[model samples]
Target: MSLTKFIEEKEVRNLIDNYVDKPKFDLCAEIKANPQTKSYALVGTAFDYLMRFHFEYKYSIIDNCHWVAHNSLVYLLIDNFKLGIEPVKPIAFLTEMNFKDIYNDSILDVKDLQEKLKEKNDYKGRQIFKVINLILNAEKEYSNFLKSGNLTDGVIKATIDLAKIDVIYRRKHYPNDLGEYKEGNIQDLKQLYKIIPDFSKKKDSNILLNPTFDKASQLVGGADCDIIIDETLLDIKTTKSLRFTRKYFRQLIGYAILADISVNIKKPKNLGIYYSRFAKQFVFNSDIVYETDEYEILKDEFKKKANKIYG
Candidate 1:
């Protein structure tokens, strides 16, 4: 789950004010810095070829440097579709040619990403294209949901909207699949409405949250986009929540402050929460429900409550 910048900043600031004399670091920055050091690197000539140019190709010249050129062409097809939300014309081709992602189902793991490059397989060649086709089908369905074949507001009114919750993890994408420490976020969203920004199969939504900080400086929370959506700082949280909780709210509160303070924007009028339930594919994707920040309160109240929890 995600940790809000607001909560992190408060904790770090408290530590400096109460725990340390000189105050070595902000709690937000210290917490954020823990996982920044590890990024996966690619290896070998074959692997390097894939990451640089070959991977760029939908399908290119076979590894043997033969004239098949399947990798480059196929890769281009996937990239074109991925780069845009539109249904690629050649999606039908995917049904015939079967290829698989070199990496397994655990796409989140860096090892899995690397395994793609380290290994080679003819059987897996066209699998990714087929998968992209399935994603397109989902997008089509969501689109039809958006339009009611007429000007009736029914399609949109019944729709759910969402913002991407980008949790800044030093090394991991999230503490856990549903984004651990995100319980507070659920509380907020359930108060608002359900929104699903993603429809394409495995089409992930992202929001930029990581702010590069100077050593020994306060972890200022603002970033480029946070300054834009001014009325409210939305964190579209996807987590397990039949009801709300405290930890999740702090996360949203933290994000709210970061969004406002970092960009020099005014605090939003409303802080919303988004709740999406999960299935066992190790992924959370369904026409799930969500809502906005229901349990609003003063930061001091959060601080007093948080202090007790941490203690």
Candidate 2:
């Protein structure tokens, strides 16, 4: 179970019920989606990638290298070959000839990818292509496309395509199990570009993207949160609804507990949800969740429950 799954347990819900008071906050102005927006999940995931790209472009922060999807997908491809599972469609094509051998030899770790991205002056259009090449083990296939500098539409499409890999990786599904490829709506990118500037204005803030809680994450199988700016832990949501429900509140609280127990560089002083579609963040101080003295008690309870379930 992950942090999300752990929090959803009946016992965990009851624990939250006894502790967390309902948060009261005003909703932000909503930005209506285009009529052509069909894939909400795709857009959400792609926008996440876009936001990371925006951060890297603007602040020169290289932090998403530890993304589980990329690392997990790499492991799955190698494991499938070892098990002699009959690879299908895209996987078969990707692994045909000596590609599997090439993949095993050239698999890049998080550090390697981070260093490579750091060396590039421009990571905006090329990030998704590098990820795709890494996943498919077909650097040659996308080499020309990466060189042509015609990356606008291609980048958006690649972002959505790469987002699809997350589902497969999370479910441990075969690569060929990926559904039909969806074309990315340019309007999604347009919306993202417009709202991103407001969010990125925190120029001097310390930013950590897709941060894990070290051994705390391992306690509940795995958990990696969105961006944490300075002392605030924020989860990016691209949903149209502005409702800050109990579940959402509990998620932020769960992340706080994880951060508290872990040896992370920064501990969150506040927790927030950045509704990307609305381009507004609803932030609440950690004190709002629990009193200073109460937090230690809560953390101990959380660890006990997590150990009971995950151990």
Q: Once superposed on the true structure, which residue ranges of model 1 sit more than 4 Å away at CA?
A: 1-127, 149-230, 234-244, 261-266, 274-311
Please report, as a residue range, the 10-residue window in candidate 1 with the lowest summed lDDT: 280-289
Per-candidate clash tally = 47, 0
Q: Candidate 2 residues 1-311, lDDT tens each? A: 68888888988887876777767877757575442477787678767766665565556444543444454445443553331222222231233312223434454443444454456536331333344454453223233344553336555655665566776566664344232454445667656657664555566657787888888888888888888777888898888788898788888888887887789645688899988777788888887655755667777888899889866
List per-candidate RMSD values in Å.
19.4, 9.1
Best by TM-score: 2
Q: Name the lDDT of candidate 2.
A: 0.64
lDDT of 1 by residue, 1-311 (tens): 12334345555445323321221211111111111111111011111111112111222221211111222334433443222212323222222343334323222222332244335333333333323333334234334543433212222221111011111111212112211213333332222222222222222322212121111113332222111122433433333333334444444445443433344344455544433232111111111111223223333343353455444
In model 1, how large is the Cα lDDT of residue 179? 12
- Report how far off residue 51 is in candidate 1 (Å): 35
> TM-score per candidate, in order?
0.29, 0.75
Off by over 4 Å in 2: 32-35, 83-151, 175-181, 184-186, 200-202, 290-292
**Count of clashes in candidate 1:** 47
Pairs that clash in candidate 2: none
